[model samples]
Target: MQTETLTLNGQPFYIRRWGDPALPPVLLLHGFPEYGGAWEPLARHLADRFHCIAPDQRGYGRSWAPEGVQNYAMSALVADMAALISHTGAPLTVIGHDWGAGVAYGLAMFRPELVARLIIANGVHPVPFQRALAAGGAQAEASQYINFLRRPDSHKILAANDFEKLLALFSAKMDLSWLSGELRAAYKAEWARDERLNTMIHWYRASPLQVPEPGQALTGLPDFPRDKLLVRCPHLLIWGQDDTALLPEATEGLEHYAPDLTRVTLPGVDHWLLHQTPAEVARRIKDWMP
Candidate 1:
C-alpha cells in the first residue's frame, strides 16, 4: 500500500492506495474511531482486480481535524469525497461502513455522477434512518450511541487517560484473539497518534446542525432530490444480523431508496463484520462489482 496526504477543500486528508492505478477504482470509507487501515485486508484481497483507495475521512487517523463541530457536517464530508474522487481521476465504486456508510449515502443522494456503484455495510439509507429515529422505539434503542455522542464532554472523557477507553471502543464487540497482535497494536497506535476523540465525536455533534425539522422525514428534506432520489447506480448492502448498535429493523424500507439493491445478512456477526468476516465480505464485494 502507498500512503500520501493531499489538501482537499483546504483540509489536509490522508489516503492509502493499493493495486494498479490502471484498474478501476473503489473508495473505501471507514467508520467512526477507526482509520483507513481497517480496510487493509479487504484491499489486499481486491488489489488484483480493483484499485482500492481508502482515506481517513476528515477527522479520524491522519486526516485533518478542524476545530469546532460544524466543519464535520454532511455537506463538508461529501465535498471532501468529491475532491478525493477528482484527485483520483477514476470511475469510482464507493464502499462505506457505519459513519462512512452515512457519507456514502449522502454522496449517492447528492452527487450521483461521482459514484458508479455503492456497497454499504451496517448503515441504513438516510431517509429510512430519519424515519426510524422518529418512529421512536427500536430506532431509539439502536441509536443510543447518537445520544452518547451528543454529550458535550463525551470527547474529553473518551480521550482521557491516554485513550484506554477509546481503544476499548474500537475492539468492543470483536473477539480480539481473531485479530493478529500486530493489527490490534496498530489500531491502538492509530488512536494514540492524534487526539481523534474530539474529531470523531464531531460527526454526531454536527448531525443536528442540518437535521430536518420536527415531523419532517428525510424523504421531504431539501438538498436530496426526491424525484431522482433513488440510487441510480447499482447497490450491494451487506448487513451483520447481530449488530446491536444498528438493528436489522433500521434497514426496513430501504428498497424505496435503492431500487436495484442486493443484500446479504450474515448470521452471528456484529457491527464489526468487516473485521470478523473480512474474507466473506471481500468475496461478496468481488462478485457484486461488475
Candidate 2:
C-alpha cells in the first residue's frame, strides 16, 4: 500500500492506497476506535480488481482531529468525506463498516452523483437506527455504551492502565481472535497517541441519536428530512447475524430507503467480521460489483 497526506479543508488528512490508480476506485471507510489500516485485510483481497483508498477519518488515526464536540458533528464528518470523494473523482463504490457506514450512507443520500454503489457491514442508516434507538427496546439497551462514551471524563478512564477499559469496550465478550498479536499492538499504539481517546469519543457526544434508559422510550426526536435520506444507488448490506451491539431490528425496514437493496447474512459472525472474515467479504464484494 502507498501512503500520502492531502490538505482536506485545511486539515492534513492521511490516506492509504492499494492497487493502481487507473483501476476503478473503491473508497473504504472505517469506524470509531479504528484507523484506515483497519481496511488492509479486506483491501488486500480487492486490490487486484479495484483501487482501495482508505483514509484515517476525522478523529481517528493520523487524520485531523480537532477539539470540541461541535467539530465531530455528522455534517462536519460527512463534509470531510465529501471533500475526499471530490478529490478522488466521483462515482466510485463506497464500503463502510461501523461508523464509516454512517458517512457512506450520508454520501449516498446527499451526493448520489459521487457514489456508484453503497455497501455497509455491521452498520445502520440514521433513520431506521434513530427509530430503533428511540423505541427503547433491545437495540436501545444494546447501545447504552454510546451514552457511556459520550461522557466527558470517559476518555480518562479508558486511557488508564494502558487502555484496559477501552479494550474491554472493544471486545464486549465477542470473538477477538483477530485482535491479538501485531494488530493488537498496532491498535494500542494508535490509542496511546495524544488526545486520540478524547477526540474519538467526542463523536458519540455530537450525534443527535438518542438512547434512552433501558426499557423506556425516548420521545420527541427532531424531525428527520426523510425526502433527502433516500439511497438511490444500488445498495448492499452485509451483516454478521451474531452481532450483539446492532441487532436486526436496528435496520428493520431498510428497504423503504434503499429501493434497490440486497442483503447477505453471515451466521455466527459478529461486528468484527471485516477482520474475522475479510476474504469472504472480498469475494462477496467482487461478485456483486464485478
Candidate 3:
C-alpha cells in the first residue's frame, strides 16, 4: 500500500492507497482508535481486483482534525466523505466498520448518487441503534461507555496508565490474538499522537444518539424521518455476532430503510472481525460487490 496526502474540503486528508488507480475504486473507512492503516490487511486481499482507498477520517491518524464539537458533527463527517469521492471523480463502492460504517450509512442516505454500493461491518443505522439504546437493555448497558467518552475529562482518563482504558474498549469477549505485540505497540503509538485521542473521542461526543441507563426510560431521542433517511443503493451488512459493544438488535429492521439489503452474520466473531477475519471479510465484500 502507498500513502498520500490530499487536500479535501480545504483540509489535508491522509489516505492509504492500494492497486492501480485505473481500477474500480473502493473507499474504506476505519473506526475510532484506528486510522487508515487499519484497513491495510483487508486492502491487500482486494488490491488485485479493486483500487482501495482508506482515509484517516478527520479526527484520526494524520488527517486534519479541527477543533470544536460542531466540526465532528454527522453533516461534517458525511461531507468530508462526499468531497473525497468527488476528488476521485467517480461513484464507487463504500465500506466502513464501526463509526466508519455510520458515515457510510449517512452517505448512502443523503448522497446516494456518490455511492455505487454499500458494505457495512458491524455498523448501525441510526434508527435501530437509537431505539436499542433508548429501549434500555443489553445494548444500552454495552453503550454506557459513550456517556463516559462524552465527558470533557474523558481524554485524560483514556490517556492515563498508557491508555489502559482505551485498550480495554477494543477487547470485549472478542479475539485478541490478532493484536500481536507489534500491533499493540503500533496502536499505542497512534493513540499517543498529539490531540488525536481527544479529537477521535469527539465523534462520540458529537453524536445525537442517546444511551439510556440499563433500566432507565428514554424521552427525547431524535426522531429520524424514514423517507429522508432511506438508502437507495444496494447494501450489504456484515455483522460479528459476538460484538458486545453493538448488539445484534442494531441490525434488526434495517431493511425498512435499505430495501435491497443483504445481511451476513459471522458466528464466533466479535467487533474486531476486520482484524480477526480480514480474508473472509474481503471475500464477502468481493462476492457482494459484483
Candidate 4:
C-alpha cells in the first residue's frame, strides 16, 4: 500500500508495504520483468491480517542493479535476500512466484532459521526441476526461453518494438483481463529503468541451473546435490495447471526435497495466475499460512 526504500548489502532497494507494522510480516517477492508492485493486489487482499512487504529484488525496478552475470549469481541473489530478511526482521513467511520462488527455496534451504514457512507459486525446486529439464521432456521444451534470455542481446530483442516481446512473454496464452492498460504501462516503465532489462536477464545467465538442450540426454549434466538443497520448513507449492513455462511435471518429486510440502493445483490458470486471480491467490496463501 506504500512504497519505501531500504539499503540492502549497501545498495538501495525499493519495496511496497501494506497492513499494520505491528502485524506478522509476510514477504512477497516478484518474478522477472516485474517489480515489488506485482504483489500489490494480493497485498491489498491480505492487508488486514499481515504486513505484506514486497521488495524490488536487486536487479529490477528502482533497486540497485550491479553489472555482470557473476553479480547475479545465486550466492549474490541469496545474499541480497538474506540482507533484506535481516533488515526486515526475519522468522516470517515468504511468498514467491517464478524466479522469486527459486530465491525462496534457496532461503529456506541455506537459511532455514530465517523462514517460518515457504510458499511458492509456479516455481521450481532444484531437484525436480533439474530432473524435468534433464529428462528432455515437456518441461525442458517449455524452458527454452531461459536459453534465449541468457543471450547477450536478449535485452535489445525484448525492448524493441516497445517491449512487444516482453509483453507476450508476460501474458501470452493466459488471461490478460487483469493486465489493464495502466498496469501494463506501469510494468513497461519498470522494465525500462536504467540497466534493468539486462540486469533482470542476468538472473538467468548467472545461474548454474541449465535447461538441457531439446531432446538431449541427462547423462553429462552435473547432478544436483539433493541433501544440501532440502527445505527444512513447512513448504506450500501452488501450481496453475495450465502453466506452460513451468509445467506440472516440474512439481513432481518435490516432496523428496521438501518433506513437509503442501501442493495445490489450480485448474484453468496459467503462469499469470497471480495477476489473473490475486484474491484467490491471497486466499490460498492465507488459508495455508500457520
Candidate 5:
C-alpha cells in the first residue's frame, strides 16, 4: 500500500493507494467514524487486479477537516470528490459505503461523466433513502441516530469518557471483529485529533435529510429534482442483510434511479461487511465491474 496527499479544493485530502497505477483505478470512499485506512482490508484483496484508491474524505483522518456545519454540505462534499476525480483525468469505477454512498450517488446523478461505474456497499440512494427516512417506519427508526449526531451537544457527549459512546455507535448491532486491536487503535488515534470528532459530526449537521420519528411522518420535504437524479451508468449494490443502521427498506426503489443496477446480497454480515468478508466483497465487485 502507498499513501499520498492530494489537494482537493485547496484542502489536502489524504489517499491510500494499492496495486500498480497502470491498472484500472477503483476509487473507494469511506463512511463515518472511519478513514481511508478502513479500505485497507478490502484493497488488499483487490490490489492484484485493480488500483484501489481510497481517500480519507473531508473531515476525516489526515484530510483537511474544516470547521462549521456549512463546510460539510453534501454539495461541498461531492465537489471535493468531483475535483479528485477531475484530477484523475479519467472516468473510474467508484465504490462507496454509508456516508460515502451519499457522495457516490451524487456523482452518479449530477456528474455522470466522471463515474464509469458505481458500486455501493450497504449504501442508499437519495430518493429511496429520503422516502424511507420520511416514512416514519423501520428506516426512520434506524436513522434517528442521525438526529442525535446532528445535535450541538452530541460531540461533547461523545467525546467525554474517551469516546465510549462513539465506539458504541460504531458497533451498533454490527460485526466489528474485522476491526482488530491495531485497527481499533488507529481509529481512536484518528478521532483523538483536535476537533476531528466535531468536524465529523458536522457531516450529519449539514445534511438536509430528515429522520422522522416512528409513527410520525414528515411532510413538505425539500424539492429534489428527480429527473436529474438518475444513475446513468452501470451500478452494483452489495447488501448485508443483517444491517441495523440502514434496513433494506431504505433502498427499496434503487432500481428506479439506476436502470442498469445489479444487487448482490451477502448473508450473516452487517454494515461492516467489507471488513468481515473483504475477499468476498472484492470478488463481487470485481465480477460486477464493467
Candidate 6:
C-alpha cells in the first residue's frame, strides 16, 4: 500500500491506495472520528482483485480540517467524494461504514454516474432516517450520542484529556486486539495531531435536527428522485445486528431505497464490525462484488 495527498474542492485529503491502478476502483470511506487507515487490513485482503482507495475524509486524521460547522454538512461531504472520483478518473464501487455510509448514500443520490456499485455497513437510508428521527421512538434511543455531540463544550472536553476518553470509547465498543500496538499508537498519534474531536463534533452539530430550515420537511431536503433513488447497481449491506448507535429497526426498510440490495446480519457483532470481524467482513465484501 502507498499513501498520498491530494486537494479536492480546495480541501486537502489523505488517501491510501493498494493494488494496480489499471483495475476497477473500490473506494472506501471511513466513519466519523476515524481515518482512511482503518481499512488497511480489509484493503489488503481485496487488493489481489481490486484497486482499493481509502481516503481520510475531511476533518479526520491527516486530512485538512476546514472551519465552520457548515463545512461538515452532507452536501459538502458529498462534493468532496465527487471531487475524489473526478481526481481518480474511474467509475467506482463505493463502500462506507457509519458516517461514511451516509456519505455513500448521498453520492448515489447526487452523482450516481460515478458509482457502479454500493456497499453500506450499519446505517439507514436518508429518507427513512429523517422519518425515524421525527417519529421519535427507537431512532431517538439509538441516536442519543448525536445530542451528546451537539453540546457546545463536548469537543473541547473530549480533546482536552489527550483523546484518552475517545480511545477508550473505541476499545470498549470494538475488539481492539485486532489492531497491532503500532497501529493503535499511530491512530492515537494522528488523533493528537489536530483538534479533530472539535471538527468531527461539527458533523452532529450541523445536522438537520439541530438547525432545521424554516418550512422544510422533517427530512430537511428535497426527496431524491424515487426512480433514481433505488440504487440500480449491485448493492450489498452487511449489518452488525447488535449496533446500539444505529438500531436494526432503522435499517428495516432499506430495500425500498436499494432494491438490488443483498444483506447479511452478524448475530453478535456490534457497531465496529470492521474491527470485530475484519476477515468475515472482507470475505463477504469480496464475494458480493463482481
**Tens-digit lDDT track of model 5 for 1-290:** 89999988888999999999999988899999888899988999999999988999899988999888888899999999999999876699889999999999999898999999999999999889999988898899888888899889998898788788988887878877776687788888998887888898888899888788888999998766667899999999999989999899988888888989999999999999988888999999888765
* Model 4 Cα shift for residue 190 (angstroms): 0.7
Residues 1-290, candidate 2: write the lDDT tens digits. Answer: 99999988889999999999999999999997899999999999999999999999988888898999999988898899889989999989999999999999999998899999999999999999989988999999999999999888999999899888888887885887788888899998887777887888888899988889888998888767667999999999999988989999989979999989999998888999998899999999888895
Of 4 and 6, the candidate ahead on TM-score is: 4
How would you encode candidate 6's per-residue C-alpha lDDT over 75-120 as one tens digit per residue?
8888998999989874689999988988888888778888889998
Clashing pairs in model 4, backbone N/Cα/C closer than 3 A = none
Q: Give one digit per residue, the lDDT tens place, for model 3 in 1-290.
A: 89899999889999999999988999999998789998988998999999999999998888998888888999999999999999986588999999999999999999989999999999999998888888898889989989999999898998899888877767756677787798888888878887889999999999988888999969776667789989899999999888888998877788889999999989888998998888998999888878
Clashes of 3: 0
Cα misplacement distance, residue 71 of candidate 2 (Å): 0.5
RMSD of 2: 1.0
lDDT against the true structure, per candidate, is 0.80, 0.91, 0.89, 0.87, 0.89, 0.78
State residue 22's C-alpha deviation in candidate 1, in Å: 1.3
Winner of 1 and 2 under lDDT: 2
Per-model TM-score, in order, reads: 0.89, 0.98, 0.97, 0.97, 0.97, 0.89
TM-score of the candidate numbered 2? 0.98
Worst 10 residues of 3 by lDDT: 167-176
Clashing residue pairs found in predicted model 5 = none
* Model 1 per-residue lDDT tens digits across residues 1-290: 99999989888899999999899999999887678988987887889999999999988888888888878888899899999998887358999999999888888878888988999988778766766666566666546657766788987777777666655555565444555577767766776666677787889988852233334334444454555667878999999887876777678888878988999988877888888788898899998877
**What are the runs in model 6 whose C-alpha is more than 4 Å off?**
168-180, 209-229
Better of 2 and 5 by TM-score: 2
Comparing 1 with 3 on TM-score, the higher-scoring candidate is 3
Candidate 1 versus the native: TM-score? 0.89
